[model samples]
Target chain A: MTTAAEFQIEYLQYLQADGKAKSDLPSFASDETLMVNLYKTMVQVRAYDTKAIALQRTGKMGTYASTLGQEALSAATGAAMQKDDVFAPYYRDYAAQIQRSVSMLEIYQYWGGDERGNCYQNNPHDFPMSVPIGSQCLHAAGAAFAFKYRKQNRVAVTTIGEGGTSEGDFYEALNVAGAWKLPVVFVVNNNQWAISVPRGSQTACETIAQKAIAAGFEGIQIDGNDIIACRKIIGDAIDKARRGDGPTLVEAITYRLCDHTTADDASRYREDNEVTNAQELEPIKRTRAYLTDVGFWNDEKEAALQVECKKNVDAVVEQYLNIEQQPLENLFDYHYAELPANLVEQRQEVIEGSL
Target chain B: MNELTLVDAVNQAIAHELASDPDVVVFGEDVGKNGGVFRATANLQDRFGENRVFDTPLAESMIAGLSIGMSTQGLKPVAEFQFLGFIYPAFNQIVNHAARMRNRTRGRLHCPIVFRAPFGGGIHAPEHHSESTEALFAHIPGLRVVIPSSPVRAYGLLLAAIRNPDPVIFLEPKRIYRLVKQDVPDNGEALPLDACFVLREGSDVTLVSWGAMMHETLQAANQLSEQGIQADVIDVATIKPLDIDTILNSVEKTGRCVIVHEAARSFGVGAEIAAQIGEKALFSLHAPVQRVTGFDITMPYFKLEKHYMPSVEKIIAAVNHTMEF
Candidate 1:
């Protein structure tokens, strides 16, 4: 036998599940202000997610995907990205969208069934929430191709669930990104369960990160619950991509603590004890624990943060509810640059209540 | 002015846009150095650099998804699928994303892309290479499906499709790609979309068809003219936002109609035209609308393709049937 090539997946972590450090922390941990901001953002995301689910339960919104145990992944990715860089996010990356200036009111309006919610007033370049699995990966790569073609130092970042790796579109995106040496970063949120299907059943591979190696690139695994590690590892990948060193795949290992969405009942297929055990290792708890142990956070500070997040979430809900329904013509207007003659007649009929 | 075939006109139009618009990009399997399988994009990568015209990995979904992304970023991406039969993999991206991008975002972003592919059956080729599934795209609300039958129309409509501020499904008829030649001017003039071309005017019957089927339809029109039954031949260049007004006017004048297509008869673009004529022009139509189309089955392989595809004889028979009725 002759040796050809060998590769190893590198694992990264800073904070353990029990308010302890696994090793020396990354350089960013020394910045107390940044760490506090990261914690605050994660808290806000959890609050927003909770309110969204409540609204869905109360018949105020449509089916909502809650990012209950994955706030650290969203917050860290958002923090690492620059304003000019585009973020192609999947449905559960609300924290990252908020960081990019997509308001909570807009998110509410989206789940409430309004197209105007996608027309971001501030963040014009970022893509809307991609509900289709693994499709956004190619869009990110295409955006990266445009950036590289224009000779701009910008990176395109995208997130997908671990189960999405099975999609052909996902592999196609990775292969093209590798072949073209495009500046894109793929972050796989290995949240253990894709709806009712667990990770073990989703793929036979030992790790999702190693899938990138097949595309001729480096793939790394990270402890997604650790806020410090999430930010550091994803930030490093983004920086490398921006420098035109080609694409990287980061597989963040986390767990989905809630049902897949407001429509799902996880208890039907999941054990209560397993859920209880996973909750102990959830993202927000460990980050909060780490902050408390380091003296950066206390009971008083935590209580204040919770209140602030609630007030913010409530205000956005009010705004979302107060917005008026878009005119029926809006449905026909944006389908083309200018409505074609056929659509014009259709729109008129709609307005006249004859359609 | 230069004599050009339909495929030649396609190449000319793409090359003209690549030269004029810096944001225009061309990519697909075998499109770069090979100039496409049909040579529809011949010499483009050489004329423009690799960045402007390039080849992509053989993934239809990626080609479509990439075009959506590039188009959102202000790049006019003209992507090609090797064949219309091979475009099923990208159907989700096209229908869900490319078609809905502008509407979903409320005009915050839109995909100004041209998805081109060689379509329809005639020349002997393998299975999955000859498909005239234009109706599948024409049925999509946000897409503009345009097919060209002649060199002049091909050159002009392609320019229009590339410049349209929305996504267009540009299906080239491989059957008639080199069957005819015409003097096509190199001027970057774009014909108007959402309109039909009146190839010949008559007062006996209106004949409607597009793509390669237009060849047989035109031949049928000529044969009908020789028989002293003046027929109005209408080329429905853009089938999606159909120019029903022109068809209605022609049918009202002629008082009879016969629609032709190479796709399956059931629920085809031909069916849509017949339904519209029934709804709005029923009073004007002297006889029932007749359709000459392929049977509702898989497009047979080369040995049986001629029997499956609509023929000039079949179109003439349809016209005679409409006239006799």
Candidate 2:
């Protein structure tokens, strides 16, 4: 006789790609104002992304990772997170950062290579944007461990790309979170492309969510293009974590509709036909169709929303450009809480030489 | 006051910190119930409970990354790696995250974590167990690299590292973990983390060393005293922000300097010390600086380990060369 452990992975898609409702939505979906606000944030993030790319082309900004077709993951994540919880984000989390009160100018400043851009006046516990792939998952696990140790009802949520699932940090984090029963949730943004490498070539596993099973946790897949599904799934995972129900892995299936960064040329590696197909299933148009079907939004409202987003992006860009550069000592100052004798001398030498 | 070995002193310091501060936590592979491979964290689990002291999966990256995570949220994490050689897996986390967390966040987030690892070779351990790569960590800007030479310094420096508000890599010299004993007072007093301790003072030649090499350095100093060549021995407790002033002062009086370390000779902490002395005290030096260090080759097996280690005779030879010059 053979004994085998059977496992089932759940996939959620409440809103179809064509903006049609596939099933009855969650209670929060009935809140038209909340849905409209989420839609507006996505629009704002897209506008910022366009402006950033334009600035890079004009030699004004540095290389930037575009959120392009994957804004729903960040939108739902940022909206569902509470003030008390900590968020450890990856590089492409502009919408999430904006929702958490990190100003657009600050994000631009960070991309411009200014360390002071990470100094968020609000959400002091929030970690800086992790540029190193899946490392933020480990940080999320550690923060969750702190919450569990203190007996606090807070959860840590981290985001990673599909390619990041193959990293050792991702696997180890999920393992520790399961073994220690920490309150954490990992949201994998399966945008189908990690630079030139496609999602299929990144891992041999059936789905990225199934990788969590090896670490003994629940893994769920959701339609990342559907805002209602994204919010519901992330909110549920966060609630489960807050209830001390170990950790959960939510894989948001989406597509990267643009180059990885301003420095990368996707046209050299990817086909235009595939990009065109993905654009049809992008998040913004689907969400707009859903809102129109619900009678909550229309073409007139969208036009006005686009104009407002442009104005907002333009103002933030001006502020970012006009901001004064910090003194040179700022580089050596934050290295430690107090400068030691050697560093003090080095700082003095640098200042004197500059003078 | 209690007479404790270096390992016992490390345990005492960790337990003391865990008791005095509720936010302090300790964890590593086999560190909880097993009390660590070398028993440096012995009896800490029972005393501090499982919540404060625990075991983690056999993953160095997670150990380092978790410490970074726990530290930013008002907790002081003292994470132990099984051995210094195993720290390579967590190199990215250490250099990219732990060392840069403070500066990257511009002081908004800081990691108050202490990564403790048993380093150096002498006990005939297997490969990947013995390494003195202190220079690699010290090279990173945002980290404080500290090593303890004796029981008292171990206890005091560990307490200081645990209480420090920044990330610190506390390297415990495994070769001297129980090599000697000293009376350490449990008064919760911590030694400074950025200063050096002068073990012996003299005016003939300055012998600079840290970690386990201090043992042979002191022995060399004693032997040199018998030969009428009094040597000033300096234990560079904090290797990163080196106490060069103390070394320079000793060199100014002695007019000669001899550095010793067990790590590979190229780009070691000794090289940094020699460079600083050459730049600052070129006029005071009566003779060129000499270094007695391990070879650039990988550490050999148990039988040949003695030859690879910097022996007392080699230190004496370096001292003789500097004095004769």
Candidate 3:
């Protein structure tokens, strides 16, 4: 474990940089299915990222944000969270939603710009994907306050990019989280670029993790490529926040292996060397090596796992695409709690036209 | 008439609503010990105790965000923004988050957050304090906006806003908050948030307006009576839903229309009125709908203010222009 005087960088990490498994690591002993499930979910998210970029090229989805290199941060965070805990995802948190049993169709429909895809009609504790920069951070903080008010023991987890720190909502949320000692964890996945604007241009601060200092809360910077390390840090922050010790700002230091979204061309702004260097820090590859070395899996099992995951993804994709189209009239109907006069007329006009 | 100022009536409404519903809470900057900048929340913190009503920091976005979160958790949050202009920082929470929460969650979660902001130009205040941004909120989907003209409407409409399942932008007419006095029921029942109120009836022309402009619209109708021009005045309390039936029926009777507002003329609430008339009641009009609105300029200091505000004279002049057309 890397320890500093101000912050304790805890590592439940099973592997070192050389891909060797550690002898001692905390076990998720309560359930092995959950561990298998997390790995499967992460693989599914990676598949979705790859498929979504291809779809965007073919013009199916609009400006999609791919969580390619950052799956470990999202999956590990969601895996460490309590079952009943609420999760508010930013535009790129597909892995968190996937780990929560949110179908791939729902996530796809959402990034596709259908508000219905955002609706969690069945999920009891999931929020829609928020895209207005740092606005969702305040919602997470407020949810944490509500949980504390109702005496619920659930931690609220949400994410933002490093550039999101410049928004007023981010500071306001952190201040409220500090002042009220709410059970919320703000994870700043410092993927370097917030849509082409690099980290240094966004803020002169040495690190985004250091911003939490003004709010009287502590923060930790972690190597996000370490999946187990990300899991342990997120889990500790969640537990601490829920105990009413207040919120923690986690800066998962990582890089975006892909473009910001399919609409972007990183070649214009980013150098080939930068991306090539990030390839050496593949989070999935690191985790897989440890699993193999620790006798958790073999070459055959790994191949089999990939085949099963691809088959599952293909089946779901087919099912979702086969679904029929819905009418546009429902758009105006959901605009207000009850039908407005103008919308009522607008809906009638559309229906008449369709007829 | 049992008279009460608009500010007093709003305070009474909040107090009565808090008394009636245990789920209702109130908070904002200078809202507790200071009793709010306009004293609308005066005696509230003391009467309801600090938990139910209290002071929040100067963070407007966080305040609005907390309201949306609290409302989704089944609490009725009546939050205050010191001024209408200050709410821009919180527009993400108000417009994107609170307004869309219900539609985003399907039927699972509904945010019943009421944003009570003092608005408009008659008050010779700071540059930012005198703004009529009602049209902006009205343009957004999934939000209900209300602007009351007098004490009674302020009391009743606010209570209606408090009970709405979707978020409501309750813009109080700051200029008329301390100016107007009228009887309001203290029994705590609010009117529907989707309907408009017909303040005056005539058959020559229909005047559609809301908020502080309601009084000016009525005054214009009164002025037109001397020249034998009968003008029907309708106050669109809930601007988003825009009680189109009342407006269409009124315009259909008059065969002429004049939309009045204190917001800038271009792309303001008046534009919607003119557009709706053109779209829905085009054949009913003897002439095209005309609008008497504030000049297309930023709300300047107290000196150049009169030119920026609409009055009875301006409304009558617009009526004359529509009649000539």
The clash numbers for all candidates, in the given order, read: 0, 0, 0
Task: Give the lDDT of residue B142 in candidate 2.
Answer: 93
Candidate 2: where are CA atoms >4 Å away? A1-4
lDDT string, candidate 2, B188-226, tens digits: 999999898999999899999999999999999999999
Against the true structure, candidate 2 reaches a TM-score of 0.99
* Candidate 1 runs further than 4 Å off: A1-4
Query: How good is the docking of model 3, by CAPRI class?
Result: medium
Model 3, span A187-208: residue lDDT tens: 9888888878889899887777
**What TM-score fits each model?**
0.99, 0.99, 0.92
Q: Where does the lowest 10-residue lDDT sum fall in candidate 3 chain A?
A: A3-12
**In terms of DockQ, which candidate is stronger, 2 or 3?**
2
In order of lDDT, best first, we have 1, 2, 3
Interface RMSD of each: 0.7, 0.7, 1.7
**What's the lDDT of the predicted structure labeled candidate 2?**
0.92
